[model samples]
Target: MSLKGKVALVTGSSRGIGKVIALKLAEEGAKLVINYPVADEAESAQQVVEEIEDLGAEAIALQADVTAMEEVKGMVKEVKQEFDTIDILVNNAGITRDTLLLRMKEEDWDAVLDVNLKGAFNVTKAISRIMMKQRSGRIINISSVVGLMGNAGQSNYAASKAGLIGFTKSVAKELAPRGVTANAIAPGFIETAMTDQLSDKVVEQMLSVIPANSFGQPEDVADTALFLASEGAKYITGEVIRVDGGMTM
Candidate 1:
């Protein structure tokens, strides 16, 4: 888990699971680049950077809307200017708009796909070049259990995440020759702001189906990302590792 001298970039790291992933990597000695979507989130992003610095690691926050290619490129250019190389990339920016398939608006589906799937593509495409030149890097995409098992009223979200799995596998194969690896992490029922919005009955129902009988914390997913980025996982690639407490099993 030693990531000393590595420069890791995590998207949507202003808060939630992404923030935790950035912190976990920083704890292992990686210099961090935190990406948030907008100016409104600048404060939160700075806070994450400061926290990483507090851990005695270097960190900087950059703004970029993952759905936009130019912004993604600019963001990567800034990182290259400051760090010279990127050793890791975690695509953790995703959004969900739940609704029955019949009622799911086209905008919702497009929005989810734009951020969850295409965002991964935009950032990974830009960063893979750097990794290829360096001949080493790690890419971890944050997916969800729903992407694997399907969830009612969340067709859009499920589709985007499932697309990410396919993207990760293809990227893995494409980059393997250059010493870069790509993998997906499917998390389940994590107690985040998103899950907190679910009703008590919904939570209870989720717990009933989960073998752990309790929701996972963001750190659980963060630890999994840490493992995939570590030297121990050099042989692992193009795989979707579930951090879901046996929910899909």
Candidate 2:
């Protein structure tokens, strides 16, 4: 196992892309800290923990709103107490409030920014301290292709993701000397509940832009994350790897 005995913390990992990332890390023998935002998601989070345990890997699910600094700090403290070290931190907690700028409400912008951007800020701020002390860590932020190539109805989402890229670069510079690498994965449209809701026509339209002629699976992103979290990528940092299947090419 490439990550045997390592401890990995992936925020908002109860389901979706975050869930897949956590599972992949666990498969590599990394102990998992699966974080969800609220009580309602506890069952789902526990299921992920159970799944990891079934895979013969240790895991615990912690609930913390990534946007809340105090909660984030507490989660970090708890994680340290349990695992003694956090080798990988995946800031995958995010939300989208899509609307054209003219139709966007203040609350919509605030909500998206708080979760997608501020949430990363809060979690990274708290965890980076530990990584700096250890003199080694991997910080992977989940960005989006929309951030690189603007989308008509996703101004807030695009801004948050773009800001995340900038934030990753800055953190990479600050932590490089400590052997910590910070990178962002800008995923294009992946098959998820969000995409499942689209009509066939809409799906075809989306596929048309993707030269691969297909939507990416969550595993594609998860695999990339696994590589980034491994020793193989120790020398790579401050970069954004686009898993867009040529959608933005």
Candidate 3:
């Protein structure tokens, strides 16, 4: 997985799984661009840049709301100026608005769909142009098992993620002739801050359905992203690789 000289852009990479993915790519010698949505997250994003620098790799922090096309385009411009080209793109910016269908508000539905689905659209549209011209690139979208099997009280989130899968496949086909491959990673119950807040009973219930009988770590998903971005996955495209401990199977 030696990615020396490769440039990777990871959205929503200030923290959580996205952050881990950014670090993992940097570890493999890829230059990184850490993206955060708002000013409030700038500190975290810069911290990620510092972490990458500490790993002896190059990185910079950029701010852009993925749902906004102009902002996404501006960010891509900056990335091109800094790195000249982008070899990898990770659409990991997503949000959840969990509520039952009957109680789900219009704003909640729109917000989730805009960030999870529309954001991927905005970023991919902007970065893929560079990849297409270069005749090579890797695109990885972070989806979820909920998008596959569905989950209670999360219709909007599930819909956004499922839509991402369709978008990924379409992008893959559209860009494959140009040597660009697009795929999605559907992660299961990964142990993050949100999972930490769950009650013992809730955690136990969640683990009961997993063949591993334990929660997955952020590294599990990051490792999968690393593989998808590497030359080893060059022949793979328009596929959904599950990092869920056999939960969907």
Residue pairs in steric clash, candidate 1?
Answer: none
Q: Report the C-alpha displacement of residue 95, candidate 2, in angstroms.
A: 1.0
Candidate 2 per-residue C-alpha lDDT over 1-249 given as tens digits, one digit per residue, 9 for 90 to 100: 489999999999999999999999999899999999999999999999999999999999999999899999999999999999899999998887767899999999999999999999999999998999999999999999988987888899999999999999999999999999999999999998756766798788889999998889999999999999999999999999999899997
The residue pairs in collision within model 3 are none
Evaluated against the true structure, the overall lDDT of model 3 is 0.94
Cα-based TM-score, every candidate: 0.99, 0.98, 0.98
RMSD of each: 0.7, 1.0, 1.0
**Best-performing candidate as measured by TM-score:** 1
Task: Score residue 3 of candidate 3 by CA lDDT.
Answer: 96
Give the runs in model 3 whose Cα sits over 4 Å from its true position: 197-200
Candidate 2 residue runs with Cα over 4 Å from true position: 197-201
lDDT of each: 0.95, 0.94, 0.94
| Candidate 2 Cα lDDT to native | 0.94
Candidate 3 per-residue lDDT, tens place, 123-176, comes to 999999899999999999999998998898899999999999999999999999
lDDT of 1 by residue, 97-201 (tens): 888999999999999999999999999999998999989999999999999988999999999999899999999999999999999999999988878778899
Residue pairs in clash, model 2: none
